[model samples]
Target: MIPISVVVVVLGGWSVLYLADTILKSFNSLKNSYENWLALHGLSIAPFHLRWQTSFFNRVFYKFTERSFKEIFQKFSVGMVFGVIAMFGSMILLAKTLMQTLAQMMEEAPSVQSDHVLQVVSSSSRIFTSRSILLSLKHTQVVVPGINLPVSQLAYFFLAILISGVIHEIGHGVAAIREQVRFNGFGMFIFVVYPGAFVDLLTTHLQLISPVQQLRIFCAG
Candidate 1:
């Protein structure tokens, strides 16, 4: 989870940027200012009928990177397979835990006091053991000021998230394009206060694809 200070900073920045964007839409002068700024940098924004926003920086960088992206995917395909397996294992574990919890609850009956006690104890023991093992493997570090994480680590955290998000989305886009999937567009969004990226793929077409292809597309992210 993000620390409070980091959360505040993100919210504050989004507020400021969103206000500017709104103002740009309403005022011709401001819109020209935005256009001029982008023109100076050889960049542009393509607004869609969605809440998410996206920008194109340089076509040259995109073309070069597009070619390399597929190559990188091919090289890491084996690692990706392992990642998908691990992801599925985690889902199975979660589902099993939930099913066991529900079974324990349904088994509880007032008339069968002795049986209820045994079942509750057994279920509680299993849940606690599984939860403890999961928690033991989990760890977090704070980066926000006044948190467990030091302020100095903020840059590292920011870069980590930015790079991770970009790479993850790139995988989805690359796989979709490689499989000849019809793509609408891609963009970033600030849902409530959290920032994330998304790649738009047609669900109908996605359903038509093979399960192996679908798995590749999802696990790429």
Candidate 2:
């Protein structure tokens, strides 16, 4: 029987290809507003155009949180302090975990396997043990043909990224609107095989804002 690792690698490769194809196909149907916006920015990449929509999720944020983001600066005044605290705490945890992982890897004895085999084994061990960086780390063997990641773990990994990305973008979006900064729209970014999200802001308007206001907008994310 084939090893479970081999099966996972095969399935992960197929699913990623399928997802990329699906997203590319969907981009062909984007509305004219989004198309115009992309054109204005000289970012008219085929199969990766902006696709705008009226989302209730954001509507709720502006509605309950700060009355359409015009009040975002005031609403998030105290929240910025909390956001900074959270960011520092996260950084500290990441540093500690990474240091510990490195120390452990250094303490590990040399493997009986060949050099190539030993390198792969060591990378896989570190990825499985550390929770700090998620799946984007150099050591992770998620989507590559020779790398193996179980289907269940892959699903969880993608879900975590999606949730985190949405929350992050919302923080920036609402804050931008509250500061009276223009929000172009939100969109997905397909960086190689990895998927991510972002909020579009008018760079000129953003630069015109006060330094403290600009810092708050950035820290919201």
How many times do residue backbones clash in model 2? 2
* Candidate 2: regions farther than 4 A off: 1-75, 110-149
Q: What TM-score should be assigned to candidate 1?
A: 0.51
Which 10-residue window of candidate 1 scores lowest in summed lDDT?
134-143
Q: Write the per-residue lDDT of candidate 2 for residues 1-221, one digit (tens) a residue.
A: 33577567756765775565556546866556555765565343423232333333555555644654445555577777887788899886776566555444544645443344445546877644433333224352224322455444655666677679878888888788777787766666554334567887889999999987887888877
TM per candidate: 0.51, 0.54
Query: lDDT of each prediction vs. the true structure?
Result: 0.60, 0.62
Q: What residue pairs clash in candidate 2, if any at all?
A: 69-178, 72-178
Residue 158 lDDT in model 1? 57
The numbered model that scores best in lDDT is: 2
Q: Output the worst ten-in-a-row residue range by lDDT, candidate 2.
A: 133-142
Give the Cα-based TM-score of candidate 2 against the true structure. 0.54
Please count the clashing residue pairs in each candidate, in the order shown. Answer: 1, 2
